[model samples]
Target chain A: MKNNLIKMAIFIKTERRVFFALVFLFLVFLINQGLYTKNKITSQDCMDGKCSALVPEKPQLSRENSFYYIDDLFKNRPSGYYRLTFQEKSNETEKIILKLNTYSEKESFVGELTVNPSGNFQNQEIFFFLPEGFDSLLFAKENSDSDGNIFIKEAGISKLNIESEKELVLLKKTVIGDTKTDLIRESQLSADYIYPWLKESKTILGQIFRSSDEYISAVSFNIDINKNLNPGSRQYVLSLRKVKYDRENASFDGQIIADLAFSAASIEKYRQNDGTFLFPIYGMLEKNAHYLLSLDNSKVSVDKQNYLEFKGSKNNDSYGGGSAIIKKEKNIYIIDGDLYFKIYGAEFHQENGVKILNGAKIEDSGKGMGKYSYAAKGKFIDLLDLEISSPGMGFSEDSKVITAEANDSASFNYTVNTIYPIGKMNFSATQLKAGWKKVSVKYSFNQENWFDMPFSEGIESRIDSIDNMDNSENSDNDSSVDNATDISAETTAQEMIQVFDFDIIPTMKEIKTVYFKITYNPNDESKAHSFALKNLQITADLKMK
Target chain B: MLKKILEILIFAITLAMGFYFQWEIANFVFFILFIFLILHPIPSRFAAGSAIIFLLATAFLTVFKQNDLAETVAIWAYYLMIFTAMLSFGELRKEEEKDII
Candidate 1:
């Protein structure tokens, strides 16, 4: 009995020891797993500094007209000043650096500097130093000029440090520039000159499509000088005097459109049609005091043949001058000069009751007047040059119709080389004439054997709608089929349909070309069935590749 | 005594295998060890020594090589083992005192 008790005691002791050893191993495994999990969590959180980094919220600025700001400086404007005030926090730093970021068309400006504290140590303002010339060149131009526009996205102070006796203390507070009131404003003006004689003006008493008015004429003149004139001796004055007719109703009108003036000169000599006394002027001189020499219209002889005369002389000349008789001849102005100038002129005319300048080479080519039509067509009109093809009849370019005559059935095929993966086919058909029509597209990988192209859900829905419309139209006039003449009138409306969401071609692998086919057969043997199919387009998912 | 030694040997082998093949077996062995320590009466000094050895081995393995799922299991098992060791030691001391009385 004592031996049995000893054996049981030994067994119990061994079991306890085994349990302790196993527990020890378990504890070790658990500790290792815990450490691994902790590391994993830490690593995941470190991505993009999303969980670890602290980002400050930027202040919002109120914008005017979705563009201008109330207190903001105009971008690239001269003297563009912005003051950034820093609110004193618990962790006061001795030196704070303010960073500026600007984006402009010509150049991008990025600047940073250590800020100087204001009078009040608690509140600090940093002024952005912008030069006058820089602002004028950058901000003083139109948006279309392609220069000098700056957009400030964000600005903030970083690396803020305080110097202590022993060490440098880094502040955790982030200083963000107050964008609400920090902006510049700029104002500018632009001007252009437009001549009244060149522009066409509409008249009330004119036909909408055609006008009975004839083309009118106007005259212009130019002078080519042979001798180079000194800067101080090149001044001249040009005058155009009209004949004194009824004064209220004059047949011819004359005006000096443009005069290339000289600086300061006296006329050396005067002759008639000699062309040897004029001098070539190089550059434009500063516009000094000049005179316009006028001739007395009442003293001059006036007649129907004698219309107007152009005269040019030195500004200081009292009597003799260069003269040219102005005459209009078939879209041209012939200037017959009595001295050294002869000008091939431009003509102005009246077309369709509106005055138009024809021969003058105007710099600005304005928009043309739209053609006026008495009868207007449909707004959605598409002109397509399509090549219609069939099996036995071959192909014809610019064909408008694919027809089946009498009791015959016909199919027209159009081959399109699709470099992209086409998902749907769309087309419009006109004058279907109560006929059975089937439209299908087949794709080829090797250009030898063709398989039907698949369609998407959108195309399937469009096809269903087209089928429904045909059924509804057929049911409305069941007796129209017996009368073949009525079929043409009934099917005059064009039908547009998109074929989609088909499982015909499972995979479009290297699909080089697709043939779109339209087959038609009329129910009646007496009637001819014809339909014009146009504007065939295929949509593709280019992103799939 | 041989059975107890064989049991411990098998446990050590399974724990090593768990690190390579399947770690679930090691976890199962740990549960059995915890149950035995809870139910059986042992000396407090012995249990304390075993706990210390287990903690040192766990630390070494964890620092050297470990996986995600096993690490998670190890962490929970660590806390459970610590609690069971403390409870078993306390029970052992009580039993020792009763035996002395």
Candidate 2:
């Protein structure tokens, strides 16, 4: 019995030691886990700061209108008598006068008309004035400022006389400076433009399928011109001159009616020859000063390069510049120069801002390659032949990238590579702990041809280092001392810097060439704008290897 | 005592292998853990630890690369939890012998 008791005692002692060891191990494991979780949170913070989209809200009252008027006289007025034959006896001679004024002018004007419905819908008359003489047109064109004014090309006009009134009408009004006419036309022209495909269409059960064709029934224009002008010392005037139609044709296969017109064409060109509608326009410009003009749905052709684009409605009250989208295509083209204008012309200067320039507010395009498809803005001249190039204040280079820094302890673990064109990029430095941190990006056209492309400015780097400067005994004393030392040091050291290695080489392609986007964030808040380009490059030599 | 230590070392090697090759043993570990939790009168925390190790191993494999084995192991683990819940409900009315089994 004594021997058995001794053995049991020995066993119990050993078990106690093992249990204590296990508990110690458990505590250590828990500490490690807690540390890991904290580090994970820090890493998430870094990711959020770098790539998350935090776009600023648009201003409440942005200068939204692009229409500027300087020339007092009309360039092209409607001369020929317009005869309209309506199904009902509708006869009326409407004398419509185009007025001009800046937003600051504070005066409004209107035109009067009489409607008389007569014989058939075929012979109806809607007579108006226009700039008719080519010399007068050129002189008038030379007279106005060259800001953001788009001259309407003859191809943008379409007029249709429908035999049936049951045809549905679709209205689309793009910003005056927008140049995506083909996309709009494609979306508007196809029979599927308004209706879904038969396979994709859902039946209401009561409605039956029919083989009847649909066409445009009526066309109208809603033109709004707003300009801020000063009278005496500053010649502030606003004028809306009628534009002329270049061609009129009908379609047999029901493809679409294609019509083109000059910038001087009546507001009626806002409608298609097929009687489709484009309406509710907003035009604005400053009086006696340089202004930009934007043509709606202008057409331009890119030399086989895809570019970033914006497509959305402009708010009536403010100008947040609509949302932007990127489009890729082999050939880039604009519908016309309808949205192109400049404020340098004689009419724009001497006319005292009388002629209300057509279109919307235009962005300044600095010295850059301007193609029909892509538009660049800045203080320099546009290298590409754009309809309008307005020179304005240039933006800072650092303004291109968004950046942020987090205060206190932080860690970064998972490093995600923003996928870009040449190849996939990986970060060697994935984990960043406390203390001042640094990162650099290398850019290249080919995966093997990496070049050091450094960040010029606006990149913030920070480190959460231990602050042992506070020598205090009390808890409050310690907190205050450390807070003052650390916060002050952080504020002083908060400088954003970005640097990359690069001797960027452009690649040439044999067959199909494309510009590839490597990596990006859809919603990054640090950026002042909506988008950011880490290391973007464009060249004809860029091709798929 | 020396022989017992050697045997334990060998057992540890098997555990490591089971953890590394989670696809093969993940379902088994999940099943054993369920049995130990719901059916066994005594709660075996050791069994829970083993199951967690197996789960971590599987997660590590899937997180690194795309693999069918890791996907299969994860799916099995989810189904096992559901099955265990159902079996515990059925055990409520079972005879003592059936419950013990």
Candidate 3:
């Protein structure tokens, strides 16, 4: 057949070269699937994590214009208790007298304040105590009569933030802790040196001062109720008792200790038509304290407009430290005058200043978020403000701290809503094991009233003969230094930082929210100890009424 | 030539046992080797030129899809109906010849 047409033209030219090499390999696999579905940028686009930040620098208490100089501060500083909060803005009603010299310019030992300005921006505060360590830190407007030109501005000299919060209806807030203590005004007399006296509460109304220190949350009393109330609400009750005496100081164990029900209508609005308003009771006082004003008014009807009048001290001993009584039915009259009260005292302030807690606000107390964590059995660790309990604690903003292993039942807790009036707390641990009562601290504003804080061996710890688990049970006189430093938490020099301090204010006064609970109990001559506590500081003592 | 190399060595051992076994037993051993190579044959103008380039790229990708491709144009219309049944029973029912399985 003509050789089959030459074998069909060489099999159609070798099947057209295998269909042109499989259509050039399917057009190079359709241009590699269209460049892998249109590119993306993968392998984790390179990775990250590297940081560094710090900004905080704006607390200026400046004044280099002839009037408020702080001799540039540093002249061997640390003498204790300092305060200066400036913000004046006058151009008229002036009468400034803010001196604090020394180093011989001695303008009367660190303390002075007498402003009388009007025309807006007026916030002039002063509280001082240097005890020898100051030559200049000025605000001298020592009154050259009236050459008004005071414009101080947001000044700040914070050394233990002071403002023993005075507010018999002055409600200020903010600026808390560390004037190093003092603020006892027991009777420095001021409401124009005390005068009014009207008396009426048919019975219970004693007033016995005398606690110049040790504790006293709030107590100012200028008396009121002249609206002759047959009104709607009334329950003024106020008790403080615990007056025990014998060593010739008299007082006699009055017992009671805590109760303050207030409401002269939150205290006559404030200076309600003058004479001298004043009103504050807030408890936690301490005679070890005794104060009473209980007036149930027993559903009024004896009519003198439902009675409410108290303010005495126009004469008689004008308060040498105790007087003014009424207690009926068991009789005890004695009232010649002496009830101008204002003991505000409540020390335990802790403010040589160093607070350094490190948690960065850990969170997860059911989504307070802040940091988040989860694990069972009371593993809540949520510290927006704070809470504390431990078992194998764990919180780590890259190791700020919450660690555990050393025990004495060591307790620490934190929380704050900040309405505050008094507070004092401290902590610094490496392996804290200061014995005697081991260590027990308790505090609370609403954690169901815990209160137990008072361990201050006066502050001076640091006698670690090897701890953090007492070096594997006391270095046993050499078994190779007890298994080579046995496992007594090897090093960090016994984790030294020690500080424990906890006096805890009178008890409770103007607290909106504050929670503290510290614990440490393991001490039966130690064995297998462990410790490393970075910080716990919660210094409180801010007042504004 | 040895039954065309034993039918391409049993379709290359059933496509390598359909990639190592159980591909539904390689689709029942390639449906019994397609009933023993359904009369066999193999070249019909290169399978009608690869089924007319997969029926014009799967009918221009199921109807002018314009580059929108992540494969499924009904799997290239089932590989253009197996190359249009190898150009209809492997060469238009042998009207001319060559091309079958």
Candidate 4:
């Protein structure tokens, strides 16, 4: 009994030691868990002066001829989050304000100011937040606007100011270079000049003047003094008149006249062109003018000519017309006349010093009225947007389809464009029996050889395998067992979507083309299987070279 | 002593088989071995203690490694521990009844 007591005591002592050890382990585990929870919040180190700014290279396409512009200052000008990083100087507690000026078709005047802190060259992120609900107002009209133009005169961080209780002073400001502004204005001018005539009809007006035997058409133009001209010439107003097209009447029934005047110094430079200078005359007419407007006589002396003449072609009526001009070789007609013109004034303050007087007149000759028509054989249709569907056809015929009776099969061949990496093939089918059908997919770079597609293990075949088996062999089987199997198989077979993902390391040297075969051999020959494939969309990953 | 040795040998074999094949056959064999162990006469304290040790050791080895067999082994060990505990409780009750008589 004494020996038994000793053994019992030793066991109890060991158990107490183990209990203390377990308590220690549990405490350690709890401490570790607490540490992990505390460390879960991620914090970025911000000591370097260099920081990332959200500078969008391309404008986001918001709609047709409308875009969302993003920059450091105009980050929230578009309805999207623009995340930018700024270096805060260490130990500096001054409040910094980022200022922005924005212009759009809806509103010409929009401004925003955001307060930030300077933390002594520490990298910090500032988010300019604009939600999706405000996207409509944020989207500015692109240069392709049909009406008057709205262009970005200035963008980006216009000013960064430090604020104190006493006053606010500018710390840094973005200066837009003259060359950069010129480039922007040049692109905007191209869009304004070309886009209108490229599309359908819009009302364009000019002036025509008839003084005795001479007829002159004058149209006002805002010529960029900084571009395509001599250095000394600040501004010039040109007066000229030429033939104009009347699209509705299918003839040249009107004359355009422009009376141009320049600052006295610019006038001397304008005459130095040696009577061979050509200026573009832009006009708009009604749709369906039957005649092509061109200069009739090329031999007209440029020195003697004071008015340009445009002749109309003898073609049939069409639906659209563009800006017209009358020219003799490269020389345009210039006439002395009274000027009345519309001036598209420069908006930016930098170009405020430039000045000019411009005028134009238009006169209808009433000789261009006529009726015309043309006939064609067949209609040209665009198939890209056409959605083709057939009723009672289980699926739409947007893709290829193949129908096979019992013991029959069909194959489809597709040529890949090879521009992107082939990712996988997704195939879905209806009316497939679970145990009775077996479908296999294979791919090959070259059509001569084929290999089975890499599929996950235990994935059942889509085609019915029982259709290929002999029907006479299972004559004695109990119907109840068959019925139970059929019910379970039917439930499993109802999942018709199957994805054959490509292998991690594809073995094909080059994927040029692929062929898919669908073999349907029904166990019962009486039933015909109809498979209408909606699409065999090739999923590809774009590879950059 | 012979029964205990046989039970241990069978458990080791099933554990290895479960790791190798990861099939239903190993699970079936383990189930049968558990039933045999439950039916054989053994002390309740010894049975409960040994079952707990075995379960803990198996779980500790496979806790970090995840796959088909690891999952199956973990599940089988849990079920075996539960059944062994129940059997051990029954044996303890029988022992108490005998003492009372």
Candidate 5:
């Protein structure tokens, strides 16, 4: 019975010891887990391609460490206009030139921009067209021997859509005349003059033509300066005038419709009869009205060795619409051939265009820039580009949260330039916690005029009412370290979902680029307060074509 | 002497393999430890000493890498406690048997 008791006592002691060891192991496991959580790394919070979109080089770039460029995974990029934006600062003012070069053995240059960076960091943007074969992009200091250091970061290139087309109109080109040398006929009236008399207002070359188009943007004249051996430049004035051809009083005069001055220096010297000179005539001309296109070198007595003239097909009536005529000191000489000319102006045409954004009809450029369209369907796009100005405010690495440290009056800005015109945007700010005194939302198109966004529906006014009540309650209390924190209904807050609905003005919508700014001002309490915007969303209103 | 040396060689190599690979090496340690339980079980006198040596090695490697130290030590401590308890119970049973004899 005593041996049984002893054995039972030994077994009980062993059981107690095992139980204590388990408890100790459990405590150690808990400690290890806590440490593991503190040291967790979120892969520096970068998603695939997004890290490539905007790169801040880990090392400081300087003259010695000069070259910084991005390939942008060129395989996915299409031939389109791309705008490169970067933040740069220099110890001293310096110029960094960005050049887009080709990838071939021959160093063919494409485009370039010289940026002047000051001591303070500044964001600069330049738009350039990307063509095939010109894939290399490099930024370098103008001087290789500079002592100062320049840092460039957040250098990103985004594809942009050009809404304006300049080279779309060229339908009014007359047949090229080469049979005759129907010149401006610059010759001395007596040959006693040093410079030719026709170089003066004595000789006026005119072509009377009518157009069905309402606007005339520019006029082209085909002439070879290969014949003119003049070393100095000569000024030629092109004038368009309303004509009343009575066949009686022949004069190159009327109320001047439009006139363009051309210098001999701009025309390629000693070149064949080719398309070179373009006279800029920007004005609205009456459709089907007879207007005279005259070229005169009355700016100076024409150079004896260098005078302006145009090529023509002699004895051949090439242009049935207009004939080449020259007036020499009141004599209107008619030539059988017409001078080769072309007129370019705006035209109207009906065509298909992009109608929606990010929809199935668009090709993915990998830049998130969807179909370029005017009438875009409504979409709730998550704003990713965040710029925080306060020292105590920043994006939590995954960019899911805009974290606000204590007393952080943070201005979070997101810039968006969409192809579609924004009519109304729906913004929802989910405030996780609140010690914020006031939260105001404003937006600007030009960054100069900021208008307060009015809420269409949400709990913003309720928050304001709560804030006012809290303010009244705390108005009489003295702020002391020993004084207990007066937790009003405002301080006793759960999550607040404030939705901001604002209709953009028509003028601002025309601007296309909108800078959305939200500022949250936290209360100046000594406690380390933290709050976050769980998410902010933007819903672009759909437009009906 | 050769038998003792062979037993230690098997034990050391299996444990080191267990530490290197989490799954395969763990099975190897299990196989060798079971074999040793039949062939050359750890005496209670050396159980505390062996556990301490294992803990020092765990600490040294943890500090050298500074990665997942807490988890590694926790695992080592749990297994060491189990092995020590088994050894102590075996010693207790042998002592009881000798007392009966």
Candidate 6:
């Protein structure tokens, strides 16, 4: 009985010792956990500075008589033609034959061009050419109701020098219809520098001008600037007269207005050190104009400053239907609306800036999460403002980014490294609390959190290659289970391959926005967030002796 | 005789509880202690004879059945009896040496 008592005593002693040691170990663990919790810091606990961000400006379009280009190779412009008659007075024949050269042998004749009895001529082609030194060859008919001019040269004439030793002046003249007299009268400045029959035959006001450098030159309705005006500041009132077609009752189905008022709002300027400037002003004008008004000339000239031009084939009385749009493979564009929101701007920024940017707006659209809550180091980020503030409790580490996992009711925060200013920020979590349910991001600046949208981050791609099985037949009955698995598979492999054809699938549809909390690291100046030190200002003036 | 029986009873109870608790190592230890106490009450020669039987049984059961409840109990009994027999053999050896001297 005594030994039994002794044994029981020893057992109790050992048990008590073990229990105390376990309790001590547990207490030590708890103490360490408490210390860590106390030291935890959050975004709000850190200092504050400017919450700086860059909001992209919305893209716009404009149009003018400016040069826009598709590639570096193609050059385009618009030109117009007026009455140009060739003549030579014949002394013997008593009759004159009028002749003009068609420049191209393989002429794609647009339409029938003719000089009417009224002497009003029409040229369908906007572009025309002449051989060298054909200047001063255009002349007006001398007699009314008479073909008084004869051709010194035939049509399709080769290069000819018609230069005179005495300077010859080309005069710009206007022809008017005289309905009362039922006869068209022609007048010109005679060799004596005066109109001989001005009092006898009513003379239209005419002006003589020097010929330009190019004999084959284009004459179109253009703004005649007395003084050069800055492209952006220049504005004009343009009025287009209704077109009169020669073919009566014919379909005047084209809708191209000859004149347009324009301003350069998006000119990309490049300033040289010497103060000279070169930029793609025409491309800017065309893009912005067509984007806004849908009337950019399909053909645009991208050469020379202050010499921008646009040309388009008339269709539906406008530039449309099979018109080539400015296609850029990839470029960046600034996007902004009434309110500058990060996700809002990013949603509209596209890989190819020329293509349209389309995405859903979570704000006011009622399509996305309306609210979010986050807690990091006892600090919370306000969902509406996305600003962080301390909860007056635990602390967070400096220079670390607080990753917030937001749900309908609860949000958890984890700290991560800083992300780039322009790229994506991705976050993931595997372990979760009970009744965790599903988690979707309210904002993820990075593509790591993909949103499934067809038009935004999706493209149509066809399957290029596929795996197939041969139809040739062979079988082995004496085989193990693993070998039979391969053998029987061969029996149906050909049919399976034929059935399982490849189809295109969307890889990622949409990207979520990632919100980052700034970290304040005291040890590193460069690595620290800009707002790590909230400036305290005190201004005063004093005089010292 | 009553004391001896009581001693055996207490040892058996200890072994039973220990095995129930899955305390296999503790049971063997207590079984050896019980053997030492039992040999103190028996004639030295008889104790030696019983020790061989106890050791054989213990080796057989513990090695074969391992942690089986029934077999574990058998091992406990075998160890306890073998420990008592070894104590008795020590005394016998002492007696023989004394006689030879």
**Please, what are the lDDT tens digits per residue for candidate 2 over residues B3-101?**
356435534543553444232344446534433333233323443344465567678876554333455555665554455454445455355758688
TM-score order of candidates, top first: 5, 3, 2, 4, 1, 6
Query: On residues A33-69, what C-alpha lDDT tens digit does candidate 4 reach at each position?
Result: 3432221100011112111122323322222434444
- Deviation of model 4 at A182, angstroms: 43
Best by lDDT: 5
A176: Cα error in model 1, Å: 48
| Tens digits of lDDT, candidate 6, A1-545 | 99999986785564443333334334534543343222211112221311111232221111221111112111121122222222122222222212221223121221222333222221111112332322222212323244322222111111111233121122112111111111111111111111111111111111111111111011111111111132222222121112222212111122321222232321111122222111110000111121111212111111112222222222221221112122122221111111100000011112222211111111110111121111121111111122232211111111112222121122322221111111222222211111112222232335255332111111111121112111111111111111111112223322211111111122333322233332222332221111110111111111100
Segments of candidate 4 deviating more than 4 angstroms: A1-140, A143-407, A419-439, A454-499, A502-505, A508-511, A518-528, A532-535, A541-545, B1-101
How many angstroms is residue A484 displaced in model 1 relative to the true structure, after the best TM-score fit? 13
The sequence of per-residue lDDT tens digits that candidate 5 reaches over residues A1-545 is 99999986785564543333334434534543343222211112222322222334443447677666655424457876665656677776566667765555323343444545464455555556666665567776767677657777656565544422231121111111011112221111111111122433447786666655665555655443321332223345566766654333334444565554445554332122233344444334567665677776544333333455565555334554455667666576665556666666543221132112221111112222232212111211211134333334433322234444334344666654444455554455544334433355788878898888764323434554354332211122111111112233355455233455455654543444567777653443424244444445554442211
Off by over 4 Å in 1: A1-411, A420-487, A491-508, A522-526, A543-545, B1-101
Which digits, one per residue and each the tens of the lDDT, describe model 5 over residues B1-65? Answer: 74456556555654553443222344355445544653545775565676677678777865454
In candidate 4 chain A, what residue range of length 10 has the lowest lDDT sum?
A356-365
Q: Give the CA lDDT, 0 to 100, for residue A109 in model 4.
A: 24
lDDT of 5 at A387: 33
Model 3, residue A120: displacement in angstroms? 14
Better of 1 and 5 by DockQ: 1
Give the DockQ-based CAPRI class for model 4.
Answer: incorrect
**Global lDDT of each model?**
0.29, 0.24, 0.41, 0.29, 0.47, 0.24
Predicted structure 6, TM vs. truth: 0.13
